[model samples]
Every structure is written in structure tokens, then in C-alpha cells.
Target: TYAETKFIEAEAEFLVANSGSFQATGANAAAYEAYLEGIRANMDKLGVSQADRDAYLSDPNVAVGTANLTMELIMKEKYKALFLNPETFNDLRRYNFDDTIFRGLELPEDHNSVLNGQWIQRAVYPSSEFSRNEDQVRQAEKAIDQPMWFYN
Candidate 1:
């Protein structure tokens, strides 16, 4: 979707700026503009009224200037815009689910005890795989709560 692409662009620009990379100066301005453009694109796609969109965008929290913009804000809006999308999980893992970057996200109260309070990092391989290739499956088995190698 156009909105999703803008959100990803916003994050990429933010990362370049925050990391003090070669394009830091331009990236900062680009990040903020892209962030707002993402919101606008999503709202427009949803058919939100212009007045309502203006009101939402004008709010202090949503209108945070470039100097005040943070990855948390960008990710929060992106998460809201893509709540049902699995891509959000990829972003969460990239940040190691840092509470600071994903403010207000909480583990479920009834989460599985096997995790011992840690986030569930990956789904267990299917039982069908174990049944068909027990030896091979065992060799590659990992705890369901173990973070993927890329995430680590």
C-alpha cells in the first residue's frame, strides 16, 4: 500500500539520521515529512473527512516537529496503521521489543508460562514436520521462545 511504503520510508530515513550516517542532515527533514505523509496517505485511504484529518494531524502529539520526532512515534503510528499485518512483528523484533521504542505495548496477562516472562520469538515448527522427518526436525529444533538468529 502507498501508506505502508511511506511509513517504511519514514523509518529508513529516521534510521539514517539517528545513526549519523552520510545523509543525516537531509534524512532528518525527510523522515519527519515522510512520517506525516504516511499518516495523510492512510487517512485519505480510509476516507476520513478533511476536517477530521486536519484535527487529528494538528494535535500536538501528532504534529511533533522534526527535532522532537522519535522512532517510537513513527513505529506507533505505523503499528496502528498496520495492526493486523505481520510486518509489525518484524519491526518489533528488529528493536528487540524495546519498551522505549514501542511505548505502551504490554504482554498479555495470561501469556504462556513457558516463556518465563520473555517475548515469544517464533512459532514452533509444525508437528507434521516432526512426524515426517523426526531426525532432521530434531537437529534444527529450537525453543518457541527463543529469538530467531536474525533478531538476536
Candidate 2:
């Protein structure tokens, strides 16, 4: 929870600092520091050894720099720290639903039949409900393969 909050704070600070307004963080460096702190909090929570965390952070790909900081890097680390959580799907939606941000994700070969090749957005309405409420279901057009109405 702290890690998530820190990541949000980092992103917010970075955006604010870059916007030319009064820097809420007072300096651009604070944004980068917050990002690193978020990742460190995650690493600590995940039981990564201090030595390993230091090594990983030094790997250039993971350690952030003021010049090198990008939304992609922040989202990638946020995604990693959020592994196995259902909210990750919502993050994908929020971030343009791109699989590239999640480097390891591979869509199942035998995907949901209704989805065909499109990304799944919502679960199918129950078959039992469909029979009892066919008219409502038809009007709702609760397509399993399409995004929810709000997203649309």
C-alpha cells in the first residue's frame, strides 16, 4: 500500500515539476528520488535482499535518472510491484491497455472463445440470467469481448 502510494506521489511530482508551475516538490530531483523510493519500498516489501535490491537498482534499466525518467519506466516498475493483483488489469486499461508495458505477458493460446483475437474487457453475463432476462441482456448488449460501457 505504501509502495503504491509512493508510486502515485512520484508520478504526480514528476508531472507537476515538468508542467512549469510552482514545483510542489521544489526540484526535479525530488521526483526521481520519489520514484526510486517507491521501487525500494516495493523491493523491501517483497523480501528482496538489500544487496540484491542495490544490484538490481544499479542495472541501468531499473535505476532511474532525472533525464532518463519516463512514464514507461514508472509504469513498468509499478506493474512489477503489483504483480498477481487484479488491479493490474485496471492499470492496463488506464494505461491504454497495452501489453508492451507488461513485458512478460503472453495471451493464452486458447483464449476466451467469445473474445476471438480482441482483448477481453468484461465477463460474460451468466447463461442462466440470459435465459431469464433475454430482452434485458439483448438491450444491454453485455458483450463479453468488449469493454464495459464506462470504458467505451
Candidate 3:
């Protein structure tokens, strides 16, 4: 939970720090540091080795404040650190699944239903809900592929 807070704070700091170029600046290094701190916190929780953590942080791709550091890099780290956590989808949605921001993330070759050639922005309410609260549920566009209320 603290990591989540830190990550959010990092994002805020990043937004303020890089208001134009959207690149890391020396003055913006605090957000960059906070971002790395988030990853370190997750590593600490997962019992990752100090050596491995050092190695990971050393890699140019994973290093903070380098040219390689961008919104995608931050989100990708968050994705890895929060794997299987529901908040993962929140991150995806907040960024609108922009391929530029989530590089290397490809939709499945054999697409699943309800998400044909598109991001499954939101799932339709459960079928049971449709029956139990047809009027209320029907108000929500009635499409499984529809984006959620906030997305609209």
C-alpha cells in the first residue's frame, strides 16, 4: 500500500517536473528516485536478492533518470511489481492502453470474444445482474466491449 502511494506521488512529481519535454531532468530526479523506490519496495517485499536488485537497477533499461526512463518504463516496472494485482488494470486504463506507453504489450493473436480487435476497456455487468437489475444495467450501453462509465 505504501508502495502504491509512493508510485502515485512519483507520478505527480513527474508530471510537475517534466511539464513539457516529458523527459527526466536533474531537477525532476526526486520523482525518478521515488519511482525506483517503489520498485525497491516491491523487491523488498518479494524477497528479491540484494544482488539481483542491484543488477536490475544497473541495467540501462531499468535504470532511473536515463534517457530510457519514460512513462512506459515507469508503468512497466509498476506492472511487473504489481503482477496479478487488480490495480494493474487500473494502470492500464489510466493510460488508455496506449501502445507507446506500454511497449511490447500485444493483444493475443487469436483474439477472445467481446474484445475483437480492441481493448476490452470494460466488461459488461454479469449476466445475473442483467436479469436482476435489467433497467439499471441496460442504462450502461449494453455492450460487453463498451468502455466503463469513467472511460466515456
- Name the candidate that leads on lDDT: 1
Task: Give the alpha carbon lDDT tens digit for every residue of 1-152 in model 3.
Answer: 66776677677777676773334443267678878888888888888999998888787767755334577667777787778998888777766677776887788887776566887776557789877988987776556556554531
Query: For each candidate, what TM-score against the reference?
Result: 0.83, 0.67, 0.77
Candidate 2: tens digits of C-alpha lDDT, residues 18-127? 67332222336776788788889999998999999999988888664776676567667887888888777776665445555455556689987766777777656789
User: Cα deviation in Å at residue 8, candidate 2?
Assistant: 2.5
Q: Rate the local accuracy (lDDT) of all candidates.
A: 0.83, 0.71, 0.71
How many collisions per candidate?
A: 0, 0, 0
lDDT of 1 by residue, 80-109 (tens): 788899999988877778888788778999
Model 2 local distance difference test score: 0.71
Model 3 Cα shift for residue 101 (angstroms): 1.4
Evaluate residue 33 in candidate 2 and report its C-alpha lDDT on the 0 to 100 scale. 84
TM-score between model 3 and native = 0.77
Clashes of 3: 0
